[model samples]
Target: MNHLKVLALSAGALTLVPGLALAHGSMRPSHGGVVQMSGEIMVELVTKPKALEIYVTEEDEPIPAADFDGTLIVTAPGGAKTRSALKAVSGNKFVSSGRPGSGSKVVVSLIEKKSSAKTFASFTMK
Candidate 1:
């Protein structure tokens, strides 16, 4: 009976292994960055030279960064506030020319529109 009990436990654990390995696709941010869920919208942030490149995800899957709209918010080294606009620079990326000194955080707000539905995501400068 003890051997049978051990066998059952092992089988149960094996059945649950696949559930632990599921990977959620798409990109997300690290520290000082967050994803907010709004009415049919998502807010995301991504890093730029001195700007924040924001991309809105209209679908559940990750969309190329080149097609995203960029909004950059910079908190200057001296605690001043500045802003810049981001434009698509290349494949899967957006960029800005605003020079936010070191230690400035770039907040990107992107919006995505899909067949009558919209979503969004945000990324921070890294």
Candidate 2:
């Protein structure tokens, strides 16, 4: 009985390997920022005292800035919400000159310049 149970568990574990191998982007920050994955794409957000920057990538490949435009909507600690537009600075990097204070929630939306495909990500300030 115990041997049969072990075999069943092993078969179940093996079945999960493919899904794990095809898992989404990395969580390790590449540019000293916070990262989240949307499908196969990775979104990284960096907060500064006077600005907020976002970076996007897929499978470790940088997504060109010229291909997308994005916006950030931040909910402040005191409950006020502010919207800021992001301008591409370089490949995979977009910047906006305002920050949502710590403990706030930031939502970023991007529209592909050519295809018009859209993607979104949300992060809580640290």
Candidate 3:
């Protein structure tokens, strides 16, 4: 019957809505920082007075920081740019020593060691 087909179609469509909503996963920062999505990976930028920490995750699960080589690029409000290498401290944490001034734009680039694939995440220091 037409009514039965319509009901089934509506139910199927409703099911897909939830999947679409979850496709992007959570954007909330778990490490008290700003979060950005790079393809399927999530990058979190945590800024400290003396250091900057980067966290990488996929589907909320951490991907080992040691698996990639990374760089931290910071651009000041006056257009001055500084680059520093990020070292893997432990687990999913990549860190660099430096404080980006307020209003500075910070970008972290991670290159997978095995595949040479790059993932980038950017943030504005506040």
Candidate 4:
């Protein structure tokens, strides 16, 4: 009887692996972080590093930025816009170097070379 219960519990735990993998960082009201995913665009608005990270995901949830050669158009404070390119960071993540000021809005526009789809994320610092 004990062995049967153990097996059932193990099976249940295994079933949650895929579900957990599919779910990325969640933006809860308690943590003051918001993770927005719409279609293939995922945006994580964070004020810590004074930066905003925009992630482009494929239909299979794989980050497309790894092999994506794109341009990032960033709009800074006082309505100043600058264009920068993206580089791969190790695994499936891309990083952009910028320091945003407090209470300033960041606008990121991503344009992939191989595709015509454009993803955008705008975050305001607090």
Query: Largest lDDT belongs to which candidate?
Result: 3
lDDT of 3 by residue, 12-99 (tens): 9998775543465678999999899999999999987799888999988899999999999999999999999999999999888788
Total clashing pairs for each candidate: 12, 0, 0, 0
Write down the TM-score of every candidate: 0.47, 0.78, 0.82, 0.54
Please write out the lDDT profile of model 4 over residues 31-121, one tens digit for every residue.
2455556555565444447444445444435465655664556555677767676556644455666656665665555655567666676
Of candidate 1, the 10-residue stretch with the lowest lDDT total is: 113-122
> Best to worst by lDDT, what's the order?
3, 2, 4, 1
Question: After TM-score superposition, what is the CA distance of residue 76 in candidate 1 from its true location, in Å?
Answer: 1.1
CA RMSD (A), model 3: 3.1
**Local distance difference test, per candidate?**
0.52, 0.86, 0.90, 0.57
Clashing pairs in 2: none
For every candidate in turn, the CA RMSD to the true structure comes to 7.0, 4.9, 3.1, 9.0
Comparing 3 with 4 on TM-score, the higher-scoring candidate is: 3
After superposing candidate 1 on the true structure, give the runs of residues whose Cα lies further than 4 Å from its correct spot: 1-10, 16-19, 22-62, 115-126
How well does model 3 score by local distance difference test? 0.90
